[model samples]
Target chain A: DQQVKQNSPSLSVQEGRISILNCDYTNSMFDYFLWYKKYPAEGPTFLISISSIKDKNEDGRFTVFLNKSAKHLSLHIVPSQPGDSAVYFCAASASRSNTGKLIFGQGTTLQVKP
Target chain B: DTAVSQTPKYLVTQMGNDKSIKCEQNLGHDTMYWYKQDSKKFLKIMFSYNNKELIINETVPNRFSPKSPDKAHLNLHINSLELGDSAVYFCASSLTIGTSGAYEQYFGPGTRLTVT
Candidate 1:
């Protein structure tokens, strides 16, 4: 079973616009969530992360919001740039004691149209 | 510098053949992991190692095995490869073991394995 799910298969947004990507989880025990951006023929790179204790985390143009009760998380990029075009993945884990294993969702291809 | 690096960017072999994929991380992180991205583009965990010790081995096939000689290196070996086993394998490293759980994973470019 897929513990992490990204319902949107693809998202397109214009440059200078806000891009929002949503993800959901079936495992309530997951206390940590992360987002990774990937380019074709390249490995995924870390973007942003949030702990269960915090509802939101932001760094520069990227922001992540989590709702533990809903088992959901969303990533927002303000004034999205063409460089942001790539596949995005949402991952989660319960705790360190659970073996530091990350479960990833099916990626969502994002295209930042200029 | 490449924090996580895997050798043989591409591998193509016949079924029933055995092969291995090597991985190394220079990030000085204590933890390393292996993930497989299948034809459908879903990334799945195959194994994880911390400080040269095996930690997590997912529900992967017995034909698959992971070896870590040191904290900076983790390798994957597959015996009797199958068509279903063909996929892009990624190596990643992070600072925490169970410390931050699954906080951050820095990945390599990925090793694309194809079984004929």
Candidate 2:
């Protein structure tokens, strides 16, 4: 069974618009959620992360929102730029004692067009 | 200054052959891991080691083995390679098992393994 799910396979956004990526997870033990961005032929790099305790965390242009009640998380990139085109991944980690493993979801490809 | 690095950015071999992918992390982290991404683009964990000690082993086949000779190096060896082994293999590292609740993981550029 997949613990984490990203329903959208791809998303298109106009440059300078907002791009929202959503993720859903089933594990109640998950305490940490993260977002990663990857360009073709490169590894996924950490973008931003939010702890389950917090509803939202924001970086320069990227923000991650987590709703514990819904077991859902969303990543928002505001004023998306052409350089922001890439695949975004959502990951969750449960309490570490048992496994503390970070599980990933199917990626969502984001295309920012000028 | 690559934090994490994997060798042979690409590999191509025939079925029944054997091959290995090498990984090293210079971040002085205590934990290292291997993840495989299939054609469907699903990323899954294969193995994880902490400071040369095997800590986590997922439900992977016995044909796949991970060896950590030292704190900085972790290599993966696969035997009797099958077409099903074709995928991009990634290496990653973290501070600990998130033992203290540290949850960041750094990854390396993947190795594209092609089994014909």
Candidate 3:
């Protein structure tokens, strides 16, 4: 079973515009949500994250909003740049599990048009 | 310097062959993990080691084995490789496994394995 799901397979946005990527999870036990950006042939790099206790977390141009009631989270990038084009993966983990195991969603490919 | 490094960035082998992928982290982290990304872009955890001890082992095949000789190194060895084994494998490291959300994983440039 896919605990986490990214309904959209791909997204396209223009540079200098806002881009949003959405993710949903079936497991309410997940306490932490994270986003990673991956370039072709490279490993995923951390982007932003939000805890279950917080509704939103912001890191510069990247912002993550979490809604525990809806079991959903989203990553928003304002004024998207061409360099922001890459695959974005949504991941979640139950921190208390101690194993640090993460359940990841099928990644969403973001294309920022220059 | 690379935080996590994997040797043999690309491996192409025939079915029924045996191959190993070596991973090392210089970040002085206490936890290391192995993840596999298949053609569908699904990143799944295969194994995790903390301080040279196995912490988590997913329901992977018996043909796949993970060895952590020390805290900084974790290696994956595959025996009798199958066609389904072709994918990109990633090695990652984190400071600790806790509920504090400080455990951000840093990943190495992945090793692409193609089995024919």
Candidate 4:
């Protein structure tokens, strides 16, 4: 079963506009969530993350929002740039397990038009 | 210098063949992992090693075996590969498995394996 789900297969947005990507999880035990960006032929790289205790975390132009009650999380990029185009994956890990294993979503490909 | 590197970036073989993929990390991390991304673009963890010891083994098949000779190297050997084995495999490293939210993993350029 897919514990993490990124329902949107793809997304398109104009440059300098806001881009929002959504993710949902079925496993309530997951306490930490992270976002990774991957390009073609390259491995995924860490982007941002948020703890279940916090509602939001921001770094520069990227922000992550987590709603524990809804079991949903989102990544927001303000003034999106063409360079931001890539596949975005949402991952979660239950710290209690202490295995540091991550369950990843199906990934959403984001395209920014310049 | 590359943080995590995997040899044989591309592998093509027939079914029932055996192949090995080698991975190395120069980041001096104590933990290593293997992940597979299938045609549907779903990334899943297969195994994880910490300091050359097996820590996490997912529900992967017995045909897939992971060996860690040292903390910096983890290798995967697949026997009797099937059509379903065609996918991109990624090697990753982390400093340590922690309960803190600061844990982050660095990944290598994936190795794409095609089974005929």
Candidate 5:
């Protein structure tokens, strides 16, 4: 079963415009959420993460917002650039378990058109 | 310097062959993990090791075995590979602190295995 789901398989946006990617999870036990960006033929790179105690976390141009009640989270990239084009994956881990294992979504491909 | 590195970035073998993949991390992290991305692009965890000790073993097949000689190295050996085993495997490392749990993990470039 896929505990984390990224409904949108692909997204396209113009350069310098705002890009929003969404993710949903069914496992409420997951307390820490993370976003990773991956390019073709490469491994995923860590982007940003948020703890359960916080609703939002921002790093540079990337921002992640989490809604516990809705079991949903989103990543917003402000003034998207062409380099931002890649597959974005949403991952979650339950800190209570402390195994460091992550449940990942199917991933969303975001394309920024220059 | 590469934080996490895996040997044989691409592997092609027959269905009944036995192969091994090696992974090393220079980040000095205490934990290492193996993840597999299937054709569907679903990334799943297969095993995790902390300080050379097995900590987490998912519902993977017995054909897949993971060995950790030290905190910085983890290896995977697969026997009698099946066609369904063709996928991209990633090696990752992270640091686990007191009660804060695991920090963000660093990943390698990934190894793509193709079974004929």
Candidate 6:
């Protein structure tokens, strides 16, 4: 069963516009959510994360919003740039799992048209 | 320097053969993990080690064994490779055991294994 799900397989946005990527989870035990960006032939790099206690977390142009009641989270990039175009994965971790094992989504490929 | 490095970025082997993938991290982290990304783009956890001790083993088959000789190194050895085992394997390291505080993982480039 897929505990984490990214319904949109791909997304397109114009440069200087806002890009929003959505993710959902079925497991309520997950208390930590993270977003990772990946390039072709490269490993995923951490972007932003939010804990269950907080509703939103921001890092520069990137912001992540989490809704524990809905079991959903989103990654938002304002004034999206071409460099931001990459596959974005939403991952979740439950602290009780002990090993910090992350359950990752299928990933969403984002394209920014200049 | 590469924080996390994996040797033999690509490996191609025949079915029933044995293969090994080596991973090492220089970040002085306490935990290491092995994740497999399959054709469907699903990243699944295979194994995890903490401070040279096995911590978590997912539902992976018994043919796959993970060995951590030390805190900085974790290796995966597959016996009797199967065609279904063709996937990209990634090695990652974190600062702590749980996902709290500076626990963001650093991942290696990844090793693609193809079983024919």
Best by DockQ: 3
**Reference-based lDDT, residue A108, model 1:** 92
- DockQ of candidate 1 relative to the true structure: 0.82
DockQ of each: 0.82, 0.71, 0.83, 0.81, 0.76, 0.77
List clashing residue pairs in candidate 2: none
TM-score of chain B of each: 0.94, 0.95, 0.96, 0.96, 0.95, 0.95
TM-score of each: 0.96, 0.97, 0.98, 0.98, 0.98, 0.98
Give one digit per residue, the lDDT tens place, for model 3 in A16-78: 999999999999899989999999989999898888989999999999999999999999999
Model 4 has a clash total of: 0
Which stretches of model 3 miss by more than 4 angstroms?
Answer: B99-102
How well does candidate 4 reproduce the true complex, by DockQ? Answer: 0.81
Model 5, stretches more than 4 Å misplaced?
A: B97-101
- Candidate 3, lDDT over the whole model: 0.94
State which docking tier applies to candidate 1: high
What's model 1's lDDT at A17? 99
lDDT of 5 by residue, B52-102 (tens): 999899999999999999999999999999999999999999996334536
RMSD of 6: 1.0
lDDT of 4: 0.95
Model 2 alpha-carbon drift over 4 Å, by segment? B99-101
Please say which candidate is ahead in lDDT: 2 or 4: 4
lDDT of 6 by residue, B8-101 (tens): 8999999999999999999999799999999999888899999888888999999999999999999999999999999999999998774355
Give candidate 3's error at residue B84 in angstroms.
0.7
Q: Is candidate 3 or candidate 6 better by lDDT?
A: 3
* Alpha carbon lDDT of each predicted model: 0.91, 0.92, 0.94, 0.95, 0.94, 0.93
What is the DockQ (computed on Cα atoms) for candidate 5?
0.76
B3-103: candidate 1 lDDT, tens digit per residue: 78999899999999999999999988878899999999999988998888888888999999999999999999999999999999999988866554347
How many clashes (backbone N, Cα, C below 3 Å) per candidate? 0, 0, 0, 0, 0, 0
